[model samples]
Target: MLFKDQVDFVRQHIKKNKLRVFMTILAATMGCAFLIVLASIGFGIQDTMRKEILEDQVITEVEVYTNDGEALDISKISAVEHVNAIVQRTRMDVMTVSQLENRSLEGNMALTNFAEEQKSNLKLSEGRMPTKDNEIIVGYQFAENLLTDAERNQMEQNIEEEAEPIGGYKESLIGKTVTMSLQSYESDEAFPENWNFTIVGVTEKPAKDWIVDTNILLDDSWKDKFQEVYNASVEGENPDLFYSSSKIYTSSLEHVKSVTEELKGMGYSVYSVSEQLEQLDVFFMAFKIGLIFVGTIAVLIASIGIFNTMTMAVTERTREIGVMKAIGASPKLIQRLFLMESAWIGIIGTVLAVIISYVVSFLANWILPMIVGAALGEDSFEELSMTFSLIPWQLVVIASVISISVAMISGWRPARKATKIDVIQALRQEL
Candidate 1:
């Protein structure tokens, strides 16, 4: 038979059973739409979580500390297999004030040693990182306590009245004079009476407050002075030689586990975000599979509907099949004709589903952020940067293939029945 004639015959049947064919197409479309939407949600969640983990810290970093509460020695970690770099941060808990200011603004602060030898892993927003003892890099809330009570009150009033974004005050505090005092929050005595500092830089606003908080990065030369002052004040078995807690960066992500295990063997407790991320990958894989499985149930129901429709069409068109056979139509042609018809139904359904799913995804991604921003009020800057849905081209192709395959498979028995019809028996049917 001519390809044109085959196409014409399929078109006539589709036109004849408009309602039945249309219903089959609708079922397939609904199933494909549901599957795409669900898969999109799954992929979006995975992408967002992966981003948060990666941006949160270096993928190769492992945080290790001694079990005996002693300061970790860099020599020991450096000697560990797979250990690439060691950042020995000296953290001294102290109180700080914006020096040379008459209002006497003070806030809670901790100072950490910043060395040229190691990566700070801190994102800077303005100015340059402090390279000298007299300079400092500040963080979120660096200027919060520097504000006088009246200034604080007025800032709050502006936010309440005008809905200003949070942390708007930090940008203005750059280049201001700051002073470090070794006095604990409860004491009036400062180890260094009047050591002055200049605010050289500020960090990018972090997702978590603890990433910055009131912590300031100071020159590494001051670590010894801090240790001496801290020990004189508290009197421990040993002055903290190195930071009690240390961050160790491995050579690569693949080496994190090996380095962590090595640290544990050396009688140290170790932690890494990379370890949690590995588990996260597994969980998301399972989560996505579960979502697709549920969506596949809808596809399965749609396939069943298509199957029934095709079976009924065969019964109704038995006489037509017999007449075509008597007119010298081959069984293969009969089978090909039915498969082509079912494939057209599947393709039409897939196109409609693709259109509907992407439109909905676009609207969801655009609108959800707006709703969340409105709800956050003055703290909207802390809102997460994420879209609820994402539809990749991979999903589009996979859904199309799956839908058509299901339709062709479902129509198999019916197509074969059309091919095997006895001319005499089929011509006796009512239609």
Candidate 2:
């Protein structure tokens, strides 16, 4: 028989038992949808984590660590191929008190090279880079945390009472000369000489909302002057024990791997965000495969329904099969018709399953964040970019192939049974 005739034959039989076919398709739909939605959780979480890592770190930046106690040679690192810039920061161990008018704040002080910082595209919220050794740049939250003694006391009291704390200094810190006093770590006594620096700029805010950037960045030229006071305060301490952190930036993200390898070859320990992402991808790939394996079990369970339905169809159409055989229809043609009907059921069910999966994914992504935020008693989570469920095209294709293949396999035994039906017994209505 022609393919069109075979299709018509299958359609007529399916129409005769509409309710049974509908239920079979429903089972298939539920199975396929479950698989997609279950595996989507893995995909969604992987995507969210990948995005967070990318946002929190500079992909092209490689952190260089010295293997020995010696400091990193900036000149040698800068000479490497594809190297864009190098930013080295030396943190002062002494307690630094920054005083602006009547308000003062104790914060971390780091000496850095302004030239290298400019090359690394260090962002500023206001004003320009420092042009003199006495000029410095502060973090975005520097002004906010610079509070007076009375305000600090009030803030402490409010914290104890679980009340909203008073605000900090509202005035702009740009072009302001701030007095910095280094205090001895062993004693509360301030050093005899105080260093005065002009605030030329405020660094850009951090990527995370919860991170407070209150660090102060001074010119490397002032490192010696600050070190002298720090060394004098701690007479027996070794200044060489203090290590500086150096970060190397590549011209582009594509060059990070090569640059990192070269730095490692030079006997320096290097870490890059790209390396972290590579590990993350490998982990998620295996995790997603496991989730898919678990989800396939649901589809297999649904296949049982397909098998039963097809078997019933063969039994019900035994007489019809005998009549077709008596009229010269081949066994293979009969089998093909049965298989086609099962495939049709799979096709319809898979299409519907994809639609349902997408709807569920959207709803989950939307509702889950709000639900979690409410449970945590924090509204900031609602603003976070998080994915709870995701369905990519590749997942849909995998599910379709699995669903349709299982349906065909389920119908195979029943289709073979139809081909072996005894024409004489079926025609006579006898065993």
Candidate 3:
């Protein structure tokens, strides 16, 4: 048969049974729309999660922490293939004070810029990282906390103690001297007020919540001062002094294994980012699976609609089928005709669904920003660009396959019934 003639015949059949055809198209359209929307949502969620996870630094770098032991042999770790550099970091909690105002501050203490030969992975979003001893760089959260009314009042009380109530110096403290004290942890209950530091730079807050709180950067040149201040706080008592720790980094998984081996040889425990990343992957997979399971139910309902519509179409076309068979149309030809009609419903419905879904995605992308901004107390949603990104090839294949499969399943029984119809009985049935 000619393609145009077959299409015309299909159109004529549909036109004669307008209600049935409309219902079939509606079912297919609903199914396709649901699938496309759910898939887009899944992709968006995964993309957002990945961006958040990798925001701070590259996940490829292994995070190593030090507890209590001999330092891992750098030479042995360096010998591992793909090993590039190792950076050691140490941290402690200390009292910070405004040197200009002489009031104690609250923050975590960090010492870095350790060895001149070592490469650093530390990044500064504002002022430079501290290179000199006593030159502190505060994160954004620290700066905001320092500016609060409670802290400002506490600083003023110190001024009252010294009889140097300098209101003029309050503004100067931003760029002026800030001191940090290194005190004994054991004697903290008896003599809690004894460590100090000098502040130099303040920068953007770290993205990770844990890293921003109680963070103060320092250098190694002030170890003597740290010890001296620590001793004074203990008042000749052999209280436990604050200790420092180091973290070593490697370039690759091979390097991490090498470093782990060397650390084991040195009688130390070690960990790597590979384990953390593997856990993260498992988490994402479970999350995606759960979403798909839920979304599948909605798609299943849509498929039921397809089945119902096809069944109705067969019942409505009983007379037409009987006439075709009476004219010597073979059962195979009759079955093919029903299948083609069902296929047409699937194809046209999917095309409509694709167009409608794009419109829906576009509107969501535009409106969601305003809603998010209001919820987050932000002026704009510039940070959160809600993308309506579709996996085009995957979507295309999924939609096409789903549409055709749904059509076939819905038409199967109807096609078989149409083929089995007795022409005499069908013609006699006016009802």
Candidate 4:
């Protein structure tokens, strides 16, 4: 068939069935638009969840410990290709006797940079990580325990009972100094070592017990010297355990497992964030699949509507098909004309779908916050961030292609019927 003749015939057919063509195009447009909007919703949700996980800290770091009574080579781990930074905490046990009004909190001290990998896991309530060895960062609960009952209640009132205690306390004690009478313990023996701790930072209570004892910040040389002095003066059983605990920071969250796996190969017991991240990714992948499936159902209904319209067009255009055949149009030409008509419908519908998708996406997002926020009360949901729809170029392209293909497929049987139409019988038929 000549291209010009096919185009002419397609235009003629469309002109004759204006109402049916419009409706079919509308159905395809609605379907494609529905798919676009749905996909955007899926992407938006996935992006939001990913941000939350990162904020909570992903599997970008590992904590390494020993299976036996020996220290793993920190140099070897640091030299690993994916290693970004490394933090090794050397611990000391000190009995803290308060020099202020009668109260005390006993815990071990450890060193940290407060940057790099472990930072996200330890959210500060107030102040900052200590740069000096004498400054201590205490857990909110640790400081709270030191507070007298009257002081505690007064704090609850001042900061609001529901306010994060660590944040409140950290702010409350910034630049304040506390004096401690430290007792050195060696195995079962003890000696007094008077010391002072300035509350430089307050950290939110951690999920683990060991984190509570990690307050003192010592540099490497300071750490080694303190460890030596502490061990020599205050002997303790299982001193080797403190030497085993080390933190390995990776270049990124994804590299954490690689470093941890290497450590495992060298015979160290390691815990990493990568495992949890993988599990979360798998779960979200399944959720996105389910969402796409649900959204595809709407598009399927639109495709069926297109099919119905195309089938009716075939029946209505029987006489027209006969006239074309009589006028020297081949069966292939007739078939091509029908397919061309459906393609045009798909093309036009896709254009409309793009416009509709944008409007729908905006209205949906804009209306949702206004309605929900008003209902929930404005202040209650101020912290919440959500994107109701996120339309990317990839989604638009996919939706357009799918819509066009579906339109052509729906017109298949109609096109075939037109091809095989007996000229004599079709001429006698009336619309």
Candidate 5:
């Protein structure tokens, strides 16, 4: 028979048992929808986590660490390909007390190269970079941490009571002159000479909300002056220990891998956010596969219904099958007709399921964040772009293939049984 005739034959049979076919299709739809929605959770979470990781740090920046007691070779690192700029910082070993008017606070002091910092894209919230030896840049939270003696005592009390500390210097600190007094760790005495610094700018805020940046950045020229005081305060101290951190920035994100590999090969420890993301992708890939596997079980269960429906169809049309055979219809043609009916059910059900899954995913992404934020009593969560369910085109294709393939397999046995019906016996049966 022609393909059109076979399709019409299947359509007539389906119309005869419209209610039964509808329910079968509904079952298949539910199975496919369940699989897509379930697997989407895995995809959504992986995407959310990946975004969070990328936001936490610069992808093109690599942190280099020294091995053993060795010092990092800046000249060698600068010579590497795609290396745009490098920022090196040396932290003062002795605790320094910063005083501004009646307010005083102990702040971390680090000497850094301003020229390299400019090349590394160091941002400032206000003012310009320091040029003179006495000029310096402060962290975003530096002014906030500068408090009077009474305010400091109150802050400590609040901390003890597990309450958020409030009240800090709110005025702009631009062009303010502050005095820093270094305290000797060994003798527990303050250095007689105090260094005065003019605040030229404030560094940009950190990426994470929880992070508090209050570091004081001075010119690398001060390193000699600070080192002399530090050496005088302590005996037999390794100078290399003062070199706190070194970071290398690539010209583009694509160069991060090459720069990191070269640094590693030169016997230096290097870390970058891009490397962490690579590991994260591998882990989530396996996790998503497992979810898809579990969801496929639902489609398999739905296939059982298809198998039963096709078997009943074969039994009900036994006389028709015999009549077609008595004429000139081949066994393969009869079987094909049955298979086509099952495939139609799959196609219709899968299309409907995909539409439903997208609607559900949209609702989930929209409503879940608000619900979570309300439950946690934190409105900040609602402000964040958090995805709860995500369905990609790849997922739709996978679901369609599985649903349709299962339907065909389920109908195969029943289609074969229809070909084996005895024409003589079927002809004698009641129509």
Candidate 6:
């Protein structure tokens, strides 16, 4: 028989056994869907993790702190290869007046110049950066404490009316002046609560694992005011008027190592997430392996269905097979025909699986956010519901392997059984 004739015969057999074909196709579809969903979720999680590591330009920069007199010389450090620039700023955990307490609360605040560092890293949910010396931008938690401090101070002084809060939350601190106590670090005793600054901006709380809170972003003008305070304490002599740390930004791994060593020698501590970031790459590798393991089980079940259907088809066509052998048909030809039927089933299963997987991925994209929103509230869900992208190559490879292997295994036993049939016995049995 011609190859085309064998293919046509397999197609006819599948058409005749419509129910069996449907079941096998359904199995293949489910298997594809499983593989696709797992792959999508794995890649989605990796993307989200990458955002946390790379977005906002967080990982590209390293912050170096110095409390001792060991802070590096900025000019010497800048000469390192691939070191683009360094942003220098100081942070001190000082008291900000808590209006709720009417007394100063122990709060740590960051005093940074908004001009040097990238703005995106400092997330501004509302308001704008401080443009003047007296104005300051604070974190979400710090803003809340400032507002509470205002209310408490008002009550303490027998003042009945305080400014009406716009939305009844800490978010109302925008565009208002709040009191925070600034004292010199040299003084062991608490300084008077006299310093006050306007709330020009409110930034999102620092990242979850951030080191400081109740932070402040101040322009050059505010730094001058801090300088004045320090100078006064030191009897008009320069006492390093402003205390600051420097951050180096770079993309080259070689430069990172070199600069880190140089900075370390200059009495500065080197800080980066290089180790933690590498863990994410390891996680995705393991995840893809695990998904393939699960996919293998689905393929095994489909193989059994293929074997049973082929075996049954062989039994029903026993008399037809005997007549063919009586007409000088070779056993090899019969085996080839059975294998062709199995291959066709494999092809059908694979096509169905790919179609179903595409549909499922679309539905998941539409429905996942709604479900998350209902469970976690709209605001929280908004942050969590990022885009989902599919892995096409993974889908194609997995689907093809699963479908073809199942069919080949299923067709093998029936082909062997057909080869053992005696033409005389098969011809006399039923027909």
In angstroms, give how far residue 174 of model 1 lies from its true place: 4.9
Q: What's the CA error at residue 350 for candidate 6, in Å?
A: 3.3
Q: Which candidate has the top score in TM-score?
A: 2
Task: Tell me the tens digit of each residue's lDDT in model 2 across 1-431.
Answer: 88788888889989999999999999999999998999999999999999999888777799988866677887888899999999998886677889999999888888999999998888899999989999999999999898998999999999999999786889888889999998757688888789899999999888888899999998888877777766775667555524589999999989999999999899888899989989999999999999889888988998999999999999988888899999999999989988998899898889999999999999998988999999999897878899999899999999999999988999999999999999998898744
Per-residue lDDT tens digits for candidate 4, residues 241-342, read: 244257777777667778878888888888776766678779866876676677567667777877787788888889988988989988887888888888
Give a tens-digit lDDT track for model 3, residues 303-376.
67666766776787888889989998889887877777777887888888778777777777777777778888
| Candidate 4 regions with alpha-carbon error over 4 angstroms | 1-5, 68-70, 90-109, 113-153, 157-192, 196-216, 220-245, 269-273, 364-378, 429-431
TM-score of each: 0.80, 0.91, 0.68, 0.73, 0.88, 0.66
Q: Write the per-residue lDDT of candidate 6 for residues 1-431, one digit (tens) a residue.
A: 88888888878887888998788767755665566666766776777777766653466577777777765676777676677667766664344333323333456566665665543245577887777777887666664444345555655555444454321133366776656656555565544435667877877655663434566666555565655554554554464644566788765544565666667787776776564566777988798678766876777777777788889889988988998888888999999899888777777777777777677777766677778788877755645546564556765776687667777777999998998888888888865
For TM-score, candidate 3 versus 5, the one ahead is 5
Residue 230 of model 1, lDDT score = 66
**What's every prediction's RMSD, in angstroms?**
4.3, 2.6, 6.5, 5.7, 2.9, 6.6
**Model 4: which ten-residue window has the lowest total lDDT?**
162-171
Worst 10 residues of 1 by lDDT: 109-118
Please report, as a residue range, the 10-residue window in candidate 2 with the lowest summed lDDT.
234-243
TM-score order of candidates, top first: 2, 5, 1, 4, 3, 6
Candidate 5 wrong stretches, greater than 4 Å: 1-8, 185-188, 232-241, 370-385, 422-424
